[model samples]
Target: MTEKEKMLSGEYYDPGDAELVALRLKARLLTETLNQTSVSDADKRVNIVKSLFGSTGRSIHIESSFNCDYGVNIHVGENFYANFGCVILDVAEVRIGDNCLIAPQVGIYTATHPLDPIKRNSGVEYGKPVTIGHNCWIGGHATINPGVTLGNNVVVASGAVVTKSFGDNVVIGGNPARVIKEIACSDC
Candidate 1:
């Protein structure tokens, strides 16, 4: 299989592969153009972001300086808003559901390296998909690690490092995040 194919399949792959490199360059150029555009140019910014992602619903708004590894590996739902400095390292798929609010400096990383020193040194890496369910709010500077799936109505506090999955309607915080409280939503 091709390197991209391997990466998408959650298998080990060489990120330095020429094809992957080209794709990253393409995404970088797009993101750079997006970041450089005037903040008042809403229409232009929207057009660029639409071109970048694999799929995005209407009503999505992302602030300036947004960056991603592979735009085609990212999917976003309706009414999604990401504040400034949101970086998605989408080596694999990064999916965000509707009405999700992401604060500034949030990092969602799907890329991960092997623990084995030899393999890690060989530049072989792998990625797992990250999924955030609907109505979630991720606080500033939070880091969502590889292979995490957050269920609906979840809240992640500032500077939280989310390393595992959690089910619906829970507030999670702190390094190696743990559930702090259950959300009590009247509408839900």
Candidate 2:
């Protein structure tokens, strides 16, 4: 398989491959155009973002300094609002569901390197998909790690480093991110 195909399949692959580099360049150029725009040019910003992503809902808003690797692997649902400085390293798929609110400086990462030094030195890396269910709210500086699939209506506290997945309607926090409290979802 090709490096990109391997990467997408969660297998260790070379990131410096020509195809991957070109894809990353494309995403960078698009994100640069988006980041340079002023708030007054909302239409232009929206257009760029829409074109950059694999798919995006009609009602989507992202603040400045939004950057991603391989924008084609990122998909977001309707009424998604991402605050400033949101960085998504979408080496694999990164899917965010409807009505999600991502606070400033939140990083959603799908890329990960090998723990073994020999493998690491070989410059081989892999990726896993990240999925955030509907009505989720991620606080500022929070990081959603690779392979995590958060269920619906989840609330992530500020600065939390989420290493694992959780079911619906739970408020999670802390370094490794454990459920702090369960929210009552009368609507759900």
Candidate 3:
């Protein structure tokens, strides 16, 4: 199977090898294009992002300091907003649903090296998809690890590290984020 195919299947793939070089080159070019100050038109900017990513919906705003490993593996829904310094290491698929608000310094990473040093040195890395449901709010400096799914309307506090799935209407915080409270409409 192709290297990309391997990655998609959640298998270990060497991104450093020649087979994935083209993808890396494309990502670099797209990153440069996105960073260019010459592109004044919003449509043009959006087009550049769309070309890099697998899919993106309308009315989405990604900040200037955004970075991703493989843009084509990332998909985003409509009305999404990513603030400054957001990084998505999408070696595999990273899907974000509609109306999501991502604060500054938030990281959604899908790539992970093996635990064993020997295996890590071999350049074989595994990846898993990350899914963020609609209308969720991810706070600043939060790290969402691989294979995690955040349910709709979930709120994550700043500096939290999400190591597990979060259910809807919940407020989560801390290093390995855990539910602080279940949000009720009456409280609002």
User: Residues 1-188, candidate 3, lDDT per residue (tens digit)?
Assistant: 88778888999987876757888788878877777735357787788888888998878777777788879899999998889889999988999999899999999999998999999999899998999988889999999999999998889999999999987889999988999999885533
Off by over 4 Å in 1: none
**Clashes by residue pair, model 2:** none
For residues 1-188, what per-residue lDDT tens digits would candidate 1 score against the true structure?
Answer: 99999999999999999999999999999999999999899989999999999999988888998999989999999998999999999999999999999999999999999999999999999999999999999999999999999999999999999999999999999999999999999997
Q: What is the lDDT of residue 89 in candidate 3?
A: 94
- For each candidate, give its TM-score against the true structure: 0.99, 0.99, 0.94
Model 1 lDDT at residue 129: 98
Clashes of each: 0, 0, 0
> What's the TM for model 2?
0.99
User: RMSD in angstroms, candidate 1?
Assistant: 0.6
- The CA lDDT of each predicted structure is 0.96, 0.96, 0.88
